[model samples]
Target: MGFEQLAALKDQLAKQAEEKRMAKRAQHAKPAQNAKPAKQAEAPKQAKPGRAAPTAARHAQAQKAPAQKSKPVDPVVLSIGKLQKRFPKAFPKNPAPKVPLKVGIFKDLLEHSEELGLNEAALRDAIKVWCWGSRYWACVAENAMRVDLNGQDAGQVLPAEAARARGLQAKRQKTKNAAAQGGAAQQAGADQQGSAVQQDAVVSQDGSAAQQDGTAQEERAVQQDVAAQQNSTAEQDVVAQHDDGASQQDTPAQQGNVA
Candidate 1:
């Protein structure tokens, strides 16, 4: 009976295992339902050809824009105002400093010795230094003297004029030097020309002397020829006279014999 019960229990376990395998097979083999496909929507249409394109009105704003303008200033008038403001005591009515105002000279003084107080000697030294230590002190000193004599700021009236004068003097000197060089070259050319003419004259004189010598030799030869001809003619005349005399003497002898 125990063997029969054990065999029955084994058979029951095998049946339960077979049922679970079948359930798993059924779950895997079931087909999924077919899903409905989503409907495709149509794309929107473009604008028609007859319709006008939209544009902004911003371009009209550019026409009404303001233009930039500059104000003009006169340099001389501005300089006068600036001078009056800076030096009210001296330049009361826009008077500049009473110094010889060479630009390079003043610049040097301002750079090296600002405390020199714009005196004539200091200005002259500055000018001399600026001119590469040239002895043009007299020029600046003369300007200073002129300013002292007139009792006014020399720079106000004479700065620009002196600058112009210096430029003009430099130009004149350059022109004078050029003219002198040209004259020297011309003189040298003229001397060469004169030498050449003298050489030609000497050559002509020598040629004339040689020609005269030849002419004199020819004249002597002609005189010798004439003398020879004259001597021959005289000898012939003497022989004829002798022959005539001999003939006359023979005729007289023959007559005496015939008688």
Candidate 2:
């Protein structure tokens, strides 16, 4: 082979190698540029309204639902002061010291109403109008009422049977008093009858004794009069006999003389 032919072939080989390396570099550079455009395109897609993330919307909706789910205020839990301020006619003043001001008592009263087959609205109204206590919740407690004891609230504080028993005891005591009065009257009548019988006996004894004394005095006077009459008759008879004798003698003498 010739030297000029060898040099020309080597140059041709070197040029082909450079062209292959350049083509590979151009391919890699083209791919890098295309990746940047794709990232840009993806950013615009995220910003578009139609491509919004449903997960974020769902999370926001969940947060809003919790805020809206808070409960409302109950009407049966009204304060005495507030009730007096709002409706003075129903609630004249605040609850007394003995009255139940605890919230638990109010809840128990509502529960008791429910047990009696009352509705929530009915209980709520009763709390406003009937359960507004001054000295005690006695108006409501004695009639569907409540009380506070030992820092706790109780419903149906009074027992009906106990009240009835107390009433019965009072009635019995009254009856016993009446019976005692009646017995006293009967004893008084007996005493009066006994006194009357004793008075009658005493009067009869006095009358009988006086009659006997009058009979004895009459007998003694009659005897004395009879004795005196007998003596007088005897004396008169003796005198008459003596006088007749003397008169006989004198008459005889006078007759002799006259003859």
Candidate 3:
């Protein structure tokens, strides 16, 4: 019901998403079983157009994800859905902008938790998730009116709370930008590597008969280097994003945000 449990729930949801993405990617990938084509494996076969497969798979996954997500309503999300129905003014349905919730709203929900058939943990997670979204953050601005359970005005959003939301939103944007830059760098590297491989293959085909074997080995080494670089960069980006998220989800900050 506190930050500890809330953070755990947040992490579990994130982990599930990442796992699904990886699984989808893995399914879309087709590894070549017929290897060691020594005769024509020269110059690394100029690198197959395998990158497009993953890209296409990701696009497909994005299209299908929402439909799939709607089917699996966990207890926490189910509770939140019920809350949305029970208190439409406080928790408006989608397409209506979310409002800033009254400060200390968690305590308010606790009073109804038993009657609503929700436990402390589920209630906490549900509310945390509701507040954690960017839509909710956008609503937590200066002078914003906080809504009570009955959809009545409770209080005004404090400068401190608005500042906190802005800071969290800034961090979220920064992390996203960093990851996007990393992806861009990786793509550029892959393109460069592919171009080099293609040029080398052409040179080999242009009567460099004796150097074909050496050329193949060199291409393999270059591919390995590129792959290692990509992996290291991606891991660093993920860690940075994770740390940024953990900091935002801490006790004090999340309390103000959730409130």
Candidate 4:
């Protein structure tokens, strides 16, 4: 072959090869371009919320849930518990029975508060709670002996103090009974209101039923009247048919007689 023809043939083959590569690349790229926009369209619009970060908020309460969560301990109660351990005789635990204490025992407790790691206010509150219980009042009879921290007798219970203790005990009991009665009365009132609502509902239902029954009776009466009217019309039609037949028979008889 001639050199010119050979060069032209080589150029044509190269152009064809380049076109095939471009076509294959475009085919591979088309699906990717279409899929990218589709994926963007399917994406969610709503913003994702952050996991709970603590903010200052406090509110609701319930009954049994309180038992599940621990409550803050009272400072006075903790102080009293410590004193009970140190001086078991003067501040005996429940079920063991309480003993009358010396009238000026607060002064004695104040002296020991520092060693026991108790503050003044908490210690004073503890002493008040310990002395104010029913068992302590029971032990405060006139002429009954008052004991020190070691259970040794220091003084006798005065008559005036004993009388005051009795008054306090009676007042506490009366208040407690009144509170219980109030709760019971509230519950009864709520029950009565519920019963009244139920009765009203029952009355409303019965009235609706009675109204429906009256309407049904009226419909039945109308149907009966229509049936009666139809029967009377049918009887009149039968009578007219009988009269026409008699007239035709009489005419035939007259013609026969005349002939």
Candidate 5:
């Protein structure tokens, strides 16, 4: 309970409190350092090789390409001078040929004048006076046929006569064919007769030639027999002469021995 003892206890308690506070601070600092190192390792894991950022460069290049379009063609133009130079005869419209009475709107004017209820003889006289051709007459005939004539008959009326003429022509053609057939038949008969005559003449000539050949062979055989008989007689005469010469030589030898 003295003052020295109390002061010593207070000093010991103060030193112990200071030592506990320093130990707590060192433990908290060690944990903070380890957390910093763990954070660094996680950063390296997140940023791996396969992880890359996306860019818009390819999309921008596609957008910048130009759009394609088809090209157009131009038309050709010719000058009037060129057209005129190419077609000189066609300039200022081509000149039309004169419409003759036979070809144009003026043919057959006379025959149909009665159908048209006009003075046909007088019209004929007028056409002759005007020196019109047959084409004008034809045109007038066609126009007259087209006219309304209150049921008047206007076609040609000679059909029976035309049919009679055709019948006569057919008859003439039939007669000509009959005559041609008769002539051909006669010619064939004459050719057959001529061939028969030629064949008979050839047979007669061949028979005469065979007879002549047989006679020639018989004559040659007779000549050979006569020549063989003459050769046998000559050979017999030669043998007789040789025998007479041998007898005369024997008589001469006997006479010499008697002398």
Candidate 6:
């Protein structure tokens, strides 16, 4: 083959190879553009209009959570605090009396001491034996205080009656008092009536005696009149008898003279 003919063939092969490489590069660039649009679409989906960012929302929720509470204080510590507040002078540092104090004082302390991990009886024993009647641990006998051994008040434990019962009792007492007063009044009235009756009886007796005396005086006056009448009649009869005797004597003297 001729040398010119070989050179023209080599040139044509080189042009075809260059054209194939340019076409491949254009195809790869189209795919890259499409990929960019797809990435933009995914970005809008991740960030919706009304939704918050995942990290930001999680951070906000964490901030809104409540904080954990601290541990509670011990009962002993609370009791000690209560005692200190109630009696600052007694428990300047801590309430530790040495001498045998009143049970009243111990009862007051016992109300708080139970929470200090010691009951009433246990605290009393501790104060008596552990403190040995020291001034720092005030201890007393069960019967040594103003209050009772049962931790009750020294004053009345139970009322005489409930409100309603007391009201009823008071009403009954009032009624009883009224009845007594009424009985006394009735007795006094009866006594007065008896005295009045006795006075009337005495007056009636006096009137009867006066009437009897008047009747006796009238009878005596009538008897005196009758006796005077009888005496006058007898005198008249004696005079008449004397006159008759004188007449008889005169008649005899006249007859003798006639003869």
Query: What TM value does model 2 have?
Result: 0.20
For candidate 2, list the clashing residue pairs, or say none: 140-145, 141-145
Residue range 121-143, candidate 1, lDDT tens digits: 44443333322211222143324
Which RMSD values do the candidates have, in order? 43.2, 50.8, 38.5, 39.1, 47.8, 49.1
Model 4 Cα shift for residue 239 (angstroms): 96
Name the regions of candidate 4 deviating beyond 4 angstroms.
1-71, 206-259
Error of 1 at 204 (Å): 2.9
Clashes of each: 1, 2, 0, 0, 15, 11
Error of 6 at 36 (Å): 5.7
lDDT of 3 by residue, 159-178 (tens): 98888888778767767776
Model 6: per-residue lDDT, tens digit, 47-154?
A: 777889999999999999888899997555555455445544433343544222322455555766645666765544433332221232122222322233233345
> Of models 2 and 6, which has the larger lDDT?
2
Candidate 6 Cα deviation (angstroms), residue 85: 17
Q: Candidate 6 lDDT (Cα, whole model)?
A: 0.47
What would you estimate as the lDDT of candidate 1? 0.45
The candidates, ranked best first by TM-score, are: 3, 4, 1, 6, 5, 2
Candidate closest to the true structure, highest lDDT: 3
Give the Cα error of residue 203 in candidate 6, in Å: 66
Model 5, position 125: C-alpha lDDT score: 35
Tens digits of per-residue lDDT, candidate 5, 78-99, equal 2212222332322111242211
Most TM-score-accurate candidate? 3
Better candidate by TM-score, 1 or 2: 1
TM-scores for every candidate against the unseen true structure: 0.22, 0.20, 0.61, 0.50, 0.21, 0.21
Can you rank all candidates by lDDT, best first?
3, 4, 2, 6, 1, 5
